[model samples]
Target: MDYYLLPIIAIVLGFLFLILAFYLALSNARRITKLGFINLILIAVVAIACGLLLMFVFTGDLANFV
Candidate 1:
């Protein structure tokens, strides 16, 4: 139970941070230069993709544990 809790918490926190970062980027888009904004967008996309991949890879193991 404790082990499961930690991973669940981590997943929630990761999603929270992702959403916060995205909102921050969007809010600052007008102030930042176009190039910088585009870079930020790209980074966000890559990060999301990597996160999803990780989740998929781990889900099998996690399911067995649960």
Candidate 2:
């Protein structure tokens, strides 16, 4: 029931999703280009969201993970 756990989970899930997106983009398919483009957007959004969550967790009072 730690306060920081939620953000940490979010960050991990984002990374996993990113990996899946990459796999999709790299797979041999007719729409590889479209998948790659979508993956790019997914990467950007996940990165930004995780980064902001980390910053908020550490900079804000929720950093009290102890």
Best by the lDDT measure: 2
Tens-digit per-residue lDDT, 1-66, candidate 2: 865566667666677766666776677555457857587658757765976777687777777883
TM-score of each: 0.48, 0.54
Q: What is the Å distance of residue 12 in model 2 from its true position? A: 0.6
At residue 17, candidate 1 shows an lDDT of 57
Whole-model alpha-carbon lDDT for candidate 1: 0.59
lDDT of 1 by residue, 1-66 (tens): 644355455555556655655776679766667666556566656665655655655575655554
C-alpha lDDT of residue 59 in model 1: 74
lDDT of each: 0.59, 0.69
Clashing residue pairs in candidate 2, if any?
Answer: none
Q: Runs in model 1 with CA error above 4 Å?
A: 1-30, 60-66
Clashing pairs in 1: none
State the displacement of the C-alpha of residue 65, model 1, in Å, after optimal TM-score superposition.
16
